[model samples]
Target: MQKFGNATIEILKDETLSKNWYHLRNITYNYTNSKGETKTLKREAYDRGNGATILLYDPKIDSVILVRQFRVPTYVNGYHGWLLETPAGLLDGDNPADAIAREVMEETGYKLRDTRFLFKSFMSPGSVTEVLHFFAAIVDATDRVEEGGGAAHEDEDIEVVVIPLADAMKMIEDGDICDGKTIMLLQWAALNRASLTQ
Candidate 1:
């Protein structure tokens, strides 16, 4: 085992499990507790890289723009229908802001008037190394420059949906909007709608 003096955790082994699309690795590490005890642990982590998501809110209309698309993971987990969610995409090699701007244009066809950084979070910290940067943008009809169906090469068949903010909240209550990042963004919008409009 390699030494990591004064560090709480030390990576002992990081072996690639798969890299077909993203990356999966089986990692072994040594964890040192506060009590001066040490234990070895092994865990598999799926690293699809970090991502970004945004809530497109139009204050003039008191509405938000969203998308519906199929997710194979959700489908295999028993959710047969498409998922309603905020526009999001992997950062790829771009920074959070740049990546989200590209994603919003590709997914919603909205050239945002401005974007406000809300926060960031790990959608599935236990297993997936995907830190999602959340943002909110104010947009209007003029921002729509295209059909906004998603990138063709990614095989994304997305349907754009525009609805009142109230209806979106109700969708959460009725269990229709179940995506984690989308739910978080919606809640943030609901909590800050007034300030956002101003």
Candidate 2:
């Protein structure tokens, strides 16, 4: 796609909205449109730092390691039960690769030695400023060094699950798996199954 000319932005006012859990800001700005029209806009942006997620595939068994946990945000938004998702966590001051490696171990007990960085995305661009890094790694039974659940002091309660790739994809179609990052990584694995084994 051809690049559209940049829109000019002038900050009018910026204020902290909240910081109980993460940082939230109310920003007012002047936006100059492509047609040379200027308009004032106000928006609230939530910043929870950044995060990382990983898909641990066991090619030997054609399965992947996943986690199930209760998410208050999703529960209030309509989902009433725990969500099945790729092992993930906030960077918490660490870089994406190191953060994901630690997260995978904590969430699934899988020690990732050859994690491949897939891509990065803004999970919710309209209101959130979190950029999530995606990764994948090939794993087997030998890689699991502990009985993974979650960090206790952080009030995390997680259940580790291993399922075949085909079943995982079917869950997505059946609405059983609704997390965006999980679905994206699963789809990527499906499309690149051959290369992943190489």
Candidate 3:
């Protein structure tokens, strides 16, 4: 099978949408299909920042740690005001694991040690340039969860929630979780929970 010629995108100009969380960039791309003729596509991509989601597991407790928060977009759309989600954070300038580990501790007060990458995926294959690298983390559940352990400085108002694995799965099935990263990571953990522990 013949493949398209190498495609490249050049940043002509980038406009920041949100301070650090989101950005809209104007770019020019050159793609040559089966024909050698060069085609240019000038388009805008949303730079939502690369991010990560951590599915924290505790074998002894038979549960996972999640977080509850209010999302502005959901509120505006009249969706569930409060959302059940996993520990996720944007990879500002750090690696996915480092970002997620810090997020876990900051949001849930669980200092995780061994974090193994499950996989990485494009958040929206259509237009968004954002990606989500996911991981499964193991942490002991003995630590007390202080309320509102969010990164207040960064405007994160997070509430930690501990759920039995079964309950978490139920919520997912009931259409409670809308975050893509959270859903993928939790589904991954649910399918591989036994192997994940041992």
The best candidate by TM-score is 2
The per-prediction tally of clashing pairs is: 0, 0, 0
lDDT winner: 2
Q: TM-scores for all candidates? A: 0.94, 0.96, 0.83
Candidate 3: worst 10 consecutive residues by lDDT? Answer: 1-10
The local distance difference test score of each candidate is 0.91, 0.92, 0.77
- Quote the positional error of residue 116 for candidate 3 in Å: 1.4
Q: Per-residue lDDT for 1-198 in model 1, tens only?
A: 444565488889999999999899999999887667899999999999999999999888899999999999998989876999999999999999999999989988888778889899988889999999999988988999988899999999999999899999999999899998988988988888888877
Residue 21 in candidate 3 has what lDDT?
Answer: 54
How much is 189 displaced in model 1, in angstroms? 1.0
Which ranges of candidate 2 are over 4 A from the true structure?
A: 1-6
TM-score of 2: 0.96
Each prediction's RMSD to truth: 2.1, 2.6, 3.4
Ranking by TM-score: 2, 1, 3
